[model samples]
Target: MVDHKQYTYRVIWSEDDGEFVALCAEFPSLSFLAPEQSAALEGLVDLVRDVVADMAANGETVPAPLTGKRYSGKFQVRVPPEQHRSLAIKAAEQGISLNRLVSSMLSV
Candidate 1:
């Protein structure tokens, strides 16, 4: 049976080419390039699995998902309308939701 433990990936957009890129960040050499977004992502997943199997045979560490406590918190903050608008625009530019942007900033 094929081992499903192998393969991990993250999808990111390439600003210069206006295309989506799937990066196996843990195994830099494992990547895929395709003109279509879905194909590129699917190819990346396959490549990552192959790379992981090779690494396993070589006795290298297989990539594993992080396991940690999930954060659950909620609060409300008051900001001026103009500032809120600016924050929303900045978050959109970074391709993240406003809550994520604020949470990251607050974490640091």
Candidate 2:
């Protein structure tokens, strides 16, 4: 049995509807809206559980949730030559490695 709680869920406020919107990144097409954030999250959990059960009953593959996935904490990004030079100069001025400077910028 799939544990719905293991899924990655988000609750965001909706200005147009004046309520909270619940979404699971693993199932992008589905959403649950409610006035309260907790209610929206609960609705999403129930919906995901039902979908998992239905898929299992029909012998369909239930997509895995993304919560437990591992990441390497490293990735590459390309920048224009001018921007790269500027960043390098900035890092030198700060007396920090370019990698450390970029990592600190991204955390913000």
- Provide the lDDT at 103 for model 1: 94
- Model 1 has an lDDT value of 0.73
What candidate 1 gets wrong by more than 4 Å, as runs, is 1-8, 67-104
TM-score of 2: 0.85
Candidate 2 residue-wise lDDT, 7-108, digit = tens: 999999999999999999988998999999999999999999898899899999888877777889999999999999999999999999999999999999
Model 2: lDDT to the true structure: 0.92
Tell me the deviation in Å of residue 27 in model 2: 1.4
What would the TM-score be for candidate 1 when compared with the true structure? 0.48
- Highest lDDT against the true fold, candidate: 2
- Using TM-score as the measure, which candidate wins? 2
- Residue-level error in angstroms, candidate 1, position 67: 5.8
Residue-wise lDDT of candidate 1 within 1-108, one digit each (tens)?
A: 234334346677777767778776556766667777787788887776776678788888875633322455888999999999999999999999999999998999
